[model samples]
Target: MTTSAALTVRVVTSLEEFKGLACEWERLLRTVPGHSFFVTWEWLYYWAKHYLRGNQLKILFVFDDRKRLIGIAPFYLRMTSVYGLISVRELRLLGSETVCSSYLDFIVNEQHKPAVLRGLYEYLFGEARKTWDVLTLSELAAESSTLDLWNELFDEAGKVGEVVGTSCCPVIRLPGDVDTYHAGLGRNRRYTLQRKTKCLQRAGRMEYARITSPREIDAAFESLVSLHQRRWGTRANGGVFADDVSRRFHREVVQVLSERGRVSLDLLTLDGRPIAAIYGFVYGETYYFYLPGFDPTAVPKASPGLLLLHHRIEQAIREGMTTVDLLQGAQPYKLEWSTGRQSLVTVRYYNRHARAVALKLGEGVKQAIKILVR
Candidate 1:
């Protein structure tokens, strides 16, 4: 049975080949609901040139019978570990770390999802028959057409795909301005926010600022790293600001996104010192929250983390944004401010080989552990 009925799938190997189609690819993504600025061509291009190097980062495009591009999925051949097992894995080029990114999915044009997925799956699996061992994608948003397309393709192809894990990406729906938001929270949450803001106000001088230019980019980034380390140093988890590689990756993304008006660096200062920082991207009427860290030692009474979030919520409303995506974390605090939630799933598509049997066993064990824990 022919999997691709009418679509043409093309593999782009050279950077030039990918760059030529970048404009159309980005345009097609804008048609998707809640499409992110993080997936923009500028951001991806910078990452490819600086970080990806000579890796087989396959940038694929699916076209309709009319030769119009309908979808894109930027994947790279790399190594990933799952439950003490390591193998060559095809992952979204955007997420190299099993760390902090909350969103990961293929770009599916609004008009063609299942069809695009079928073409992509057919191409990947057919190639995998001779090439790779496993294809994995983590942090796929449950609300996206990405999951729907995967489900459709697997059902039609009669292939087995397993869900490895699930997590929540929280989002706060902005109804009105800051006061309105505070009014909507639970009594304790409301009081906490009020008390925190008031405390900060009383302590010397407090200010909020957004950094969005190439010139101001350097200092803003340094402040983020310093604050992040100070906050998470106790737990010994370096957070996003831990090392040079992660910091470089972030700065590169920001520089690319800032030029396109998609990035913002929100800073909170107290007594002339930067106390908290947030790196977020704005796209399609929503603020996609990314890395945020605060000075845990400074003004513990002010609750700097919560203070930063409160300011961002108000900022969102002031900017007329419809929502603020808190990103993927099962943190209890996400529920306090979030009015809505989205589920993110980890996907494992098995190859028909010895690897498949191994993965099946691993999946069974994982499921058993999850059930026992529950």
Candidate 2:
């Protein structure tokens, strides 16, 4: 472990420092256990450097006594229309839109999350208490220990901290081989699995292929893009694979993750040609369902995407993964396999102004629509 005498905490408020810190942050991330490509220096840097045009993205870093990076918290100071239509400031991590981003929260060294969060809140809330109205975070993973800490801190602060919103995330527990998992799903789901596997087998030699090395990453990426484009065409949200940024990010993520042997880029192929691919991460005992695509032309009969998922789950069971997390989604199929749902909540910490109230109203509107649909 690195020494702590030279340890220092800095909040990079300027773009120049932000850029420099990102370089260091990424370098350290590669060494951190379970570091994800999404939180990689390049991924976050590219997004912040591009989308943050005039948007103040404040990046905070914690250096050990040796001046070596140990933690990072990527956040932004921005103006939204909710706070009385005024430019009331707040700090938040860069994440997907409510309609899109699956989850949110900062990436810190697993060992340093507690320290980083404490330092981050101190600086953000301490300095901006007079100028900013809120300090909000969204889509935090329910299983994360940081969420538990946040709850404790909120209680200690004696300030208003609310769950605000909650949503379900489904997961599959994989034990032993695919056959064992199939048997565990019980009569109905097991029957469907048997039928689907048979149908898929009749269509072609259904084989599950995983791109496990950096050497295979390029070809696997091309296969993923080709199938994704063919599957979604113009209707699928272009943000995923339609643009250079996203495509490049995915490639880099796969390469990095494959290097660690923690990424599962599973492909369903017929004969020798690829038809469907599911890109996800297998960390510890959890398999994260990140992204997937298939050839639309081969749908109905092939059902490549669904078949690939089936195979992936089976593989996970064989690998002894305890959970196959669907991440965030309301997909009916996810419910079909998931026996339990992990509830997630969103919260915002405020210093002043009516921003909290406006946010609550927006939440109410969202809830009303959800209730109406249900």
Give the best candidate by TM-score. 1
Off by over 4 Å in 2: 1-8, 13-53, 62-72, 83-85, 96-119, 143-164, 234-239, 353-374
Instruction: Please report the candidate that would top lDDT against the real structure.
Output: 1
lDDT, candidates in the order shown: 0.74, 0.67
Q: Across residues 245-346, which tens digit of lDDT does each residue of candidate 1 receive? A: 667777777776777788888899997789999988888789988788888887889888778878887888899999999888857888866888988788
What is the C-alpha local distance difference test score of candidate 1? 0.74
TM-score of 2: 0.74
What is the C-alpha lDDT profile of model 2 across 1-374, one tens digit per residue? Answer: 11223345666776666666655776776656644334555446656654565668676677766666677777777766664564556666665332234445576657777766666556555654565666667666667676878767656765555565667778776666766666677898667767877877887777789888889877987888888787775775753677776675567767766877767778988777888988788776777888788887763565678878877887777777878888777689888878677766677765534554455456575533332233
Residue 50's lDDT in candidate 1? 54
What TM value does model 1 have?
0.86
**Model 2: lDDT of residue 90:** 66
